[model samples]
Target: MTLQQRVNELVRACFAGIWIESHEHTDAIAELAGMCRDEQWRLVTWDIERGLRGPSGSPSEHDAGDPLAAVRAISSLADGETPAIVVLQNFHRFMQSAEIVQALAHAIHDGKQRRGFVVVLSPVVQLPVELEKLFVTVEHALPDRQQLLEVAAGIATEDDEMPEDAQLDAVLDAAAGLTRYEAEGAFSLSLVRDGVLAPSTIWELKTQAVQKSGLLSIHRGAETFDSLGGLDALKAFTRRAMMNRRSDGQAVRPRGVMLLSPPGCGKSEFCKCLGNEVGRPVLTLDVGSLMGSLVGQSEERTRQALQTVDAMAPCVLMIDEVEKAFAGSASGGVNDSGVSSRMMGTFLTWLNDHASDVFVVCTANDVQRLPPEFSRAERFDGVFFVDLPGREQKDAIWALYRQRYDIDLSETCPADDQWTGAEIKSCCRLAALLDVPLTQAATNVVPVAVTSAESIDRLRQWADGRCLSADTPGFFRKEVNSGKRRRRVTTKPSVN
Candidate 1:
């Protein structure tokens, strides 16, 4: 349910303490305060020093510093025959007190008989076991597109003319993922910087908003589809999936795609390039950076990061090599004391239920290492197995590297060496610096296929019929042709 509906329901259900978990503290308080006023509930305020304040903004004759006084104030509202909402600001600190605990429990039971309610407002969440069962928790979301637009419109006094549909969308898109107050600050900043609303100014403000989180950053890297060579099937699939929503006018599909294959096969690069093709910024999520010392803190951090990505919807969220983040946790071992499992669970839930336009692009090196549930159908649009770069793919890779490093590839011809695209690029780069031809640069280099030939062959054998080949039919067909030729040659010699 939406935050407002949830609060209304909680109040109607006679819930005494409502714990709102959110980063948009000011906006939440303002919205809840307004909601209380609309519901005709008498409003009361509280803090550590000030126990409670009445609707008149009048200080109590009591010292206003005791927890018991706050409970008594709630009781006083019931005696006056008026429904009351007691907003306890920063009262979470006093929750550990035994007397306060019993008092709150007693107040909740007592308030249900009358028009009295308790609202706990705290910047941080610190619920003890005893209060967990008593309080109802809800998350106060940051400002969405409509809300941001309203804020922007409110500040535009001089140029009352509304922004064009496309420009307005762009402005809202940039303003997304920011809280109401933050969006207001950004809107004001934009007006002051440019004297009018502009898309560029919104972007500058968005950068600030993302920087404030430090969990997720708004990336501006431009990687075009043309930059990637070969893998036409994968490219076509990506293009189709991205445009599916626009063409059919349907709600975008749930889940994203997982690109799995050997290392250095352009999985990460393909993910990066998709953002450019789709005309959306890319945000990279580094899972390792989320771990924390406190219990549940890591999960909270992950939620915050994903929330940021959701705020910046209609963008690519790239989790490069996610296997490193969640591997072998299914065994339920205590290596990290189940932190990995909790982290994985949090991510999986988001992947399944996330309805936003955030397109997740997760790349993994070893499918064996990845949790099986992650590769299941519907979780991702498709699971592409990127095999070793064939000879044709290698040629295209070489051309790209040659252009990248200004190398004269005409002098160095590619052969049947098992060099991946990344290795080939590295060879070319080294060749340029050493003043040697690209062929010589590869003399000391060994690719994964060579060092781990058995494993590569096993992967290839497993994928032979099950997975789609990235290379053209001509290359794979050659193996069949050669086998046929060998059978014919042996049979003919026996007949003769």
Candidate 2:
């Protein structure tokens, strides 16, 4: 339901205090006013600039922008039996004052009998401890595709200024997760520059919006599955999953995968490329950035960030190095007073229950640090383990990077045993950068397999028969060749 509908029900049921979380105050207030007008209820608004506004649209400066006075006057604004609503704009700013908190608490408690409703409208919810029990939060969601189309119609006056069917769908897709105000600005800007409502212009603005929030960073690069080699099973699985997804949600959608691989493997690269492959934007979420200094701030930031992720639906959400992100959750709140645990709980709940078309891609180098419940069934479509590249996969990876670095085809590669795709790319890049032979460049590069062999072996042993294979369809199996040497990689033409 919309914000107005939700608020309408709560007010009629005599919910004394309501909190509206919104970024666009003007639009929210307009909707509330319209609802109140239709219901024949008294509506009053207050802000720092405009102390008080009654149903008559006149400002009451008697309170002189004092929040305590404004809250106290809410009951007086109501008729004998008519429900009166006082929307204090940005009321979270004054929550720190003990006097304001007390006044709000008493006002909300007494409002139960007097039919007085106090609503706090702000971008964030920061309820003081005393008033927390009395208030219920209602989020003002961003516009959906249909509403966004109406917005595009308002901006694109000329028929030529609007795009055709498929192009219009792209435009609506780009406008998702944006507020009505932001959508208008983006649509107008797109018309001015491209002469039509285009997705590219709106995408650029959306990227800026994501960056400004400091929650997630969006990647809309040209990289696709063609850029890398190996992980045939993974690539095919994701592509098929995308194809099978029904936009109407009639069928079970792809829940995404948990990628467990050693460092320098292609886990992160595969996630970045999946976006371009499926025509979705990849949103990289850094959990460390969600931490806050104040109490309950981290959890709130986590929820807000995930909400933003959900709003930008039909997209990929990648959480890199996730094992370290929620490490504190594993220790049962022994670290940092359970902040990390709470944050992880919020994320886990969202992961298991969110209905958005978000294909989550979480990469982990160490599975030991992750909570066991995280990898449980239904949370992810599958847990796929990416091991070191085999002979054929290595050949394909080497060929792609060699072409990228402009290396000669006849040149032979140095002995490469247990090398990851990233290591091979690094060797090729170093060979081009140093103007040396591939063999000589290989001398300067040390593979993670050699550096962390013990840990990598243990990880492989644990994943054997437990996780799905990225290169094959069945469960992953260890080669069991500890007594023998791995095959040395040489310059060979790849079949793929």
Candidate 3:
């Protein structure tokens, strides 16, 4: 619902205390003013700088620049027949004052009888214990597509500056989560930088915004599915899922996929590539950075990060090495005083329930360390096991990397049995860096299959018949090699 409709109903119902969380105060106040004018209700606005201004366009006697006085003055505007609204601008800053808190509590109780409402408008809602139950918090939503298009059109007035319908739609998509002011700024900046408006400038501003937040980072790269080889099954599944459209022509969003594999298996690279393949921005969420030093801060940061993810819809959220992120969640409050557990719970709930068009890709080298509930159905579309590249896949990876590093295809490639895509790339990089033969460069590279042999075996065993194969359809199975035929060889060895 729009802010006007919500405030209209609440004031009519005599809800005395209303808290509006909004980043764009000018737009919110303008909306409230229009609503009040239409409903024939008296509207008064207050702020520390401007004091209290009544509907008559004059400062009231109670305009003392004091929040306590502002609360006490609400009763004077109360009337049984007509509703009155008092808007407190940035009043959360004064919530720490005892006098202001007590006065607000009493005014809210008395305003119910007189049909008066107190609306607190701030960027954030910080309610004191006394007024918590009395106030109803409402979020001022970001601009929708229509609003963003209007904003773009308003800024791009010139004939050549305005984008066509298709380009305009793209621009709107880029401006999805931006506030009204931010959208205006982005559109204006885009026009100033480029002769016409484009998504590039908006995305640049968005990346800077995410970086400033410190909770989420935006991945902007040219990497596409063609850059990586293998994982055809995984790529096809995600593409089909992301491309599926509803009757309304909106794409059906896939929940996500849980990728389990050993190190250097292309899990992270695939995630980054998938975003570009699907035409969505990839958001890299670092769970470790979400951890805060203060109590309850970690949980708050988790919520904020999820909110940001939801805001930036039609994007991919990549949580790399998720097992380490939630390492201590299974233990019951033993380590880190339950911070990890609470943060994990918050993330799990969001992952399961979020309706945003975000495709989540969580890569984990060790699924055994993750909670079992995390892999349950509905949390993700499927749990995929990415094993070492097979012969064909390895050859394809080598061909790509050899071209990338200017290695001669005629030069016999080193033996790459059980080598992963990452290992192949590393070998190519080392060969180029040292100006040595591929075989000589192989000495500097150690494949994870050999370094973590026991762990890899255990992972393959656990994933057998349990997870989907990233390379082919159906459940993954570890190929068991029966002992080579040794009937005649054993006798020959004994004779020798």
Which prediction has the highest lDDT against the true structure? Answer: 2
TM-score to native of every candidate shown: 0.86, 0.95, 0.90
Which candidate, 2 or 3, would have the higher TM-score against the true structure? 2
lDDT of 2: 0.89
Note the clash tally of each candidate: 1, 0, 0
- lDDT for every model? 0.73, 0.89, 0.86
RMSD of candidates 1 onward, in order: 5.8, 4.1, 6.3
Winner on TM-score between 1 and 3 is 3
Top TM-score: which candidate number? 2
Model 2 TM-score, all chains together? 0.95
Q: Which pairs in model 2 have colliding backbones? A: none
Model 3 accuracy (lDDT, Cα) = 0.86
Angstrom error at residue 134, model 3: 2.3
Off by over 4 Å in 2: 55-57, 61-63, 245-250, 482-496
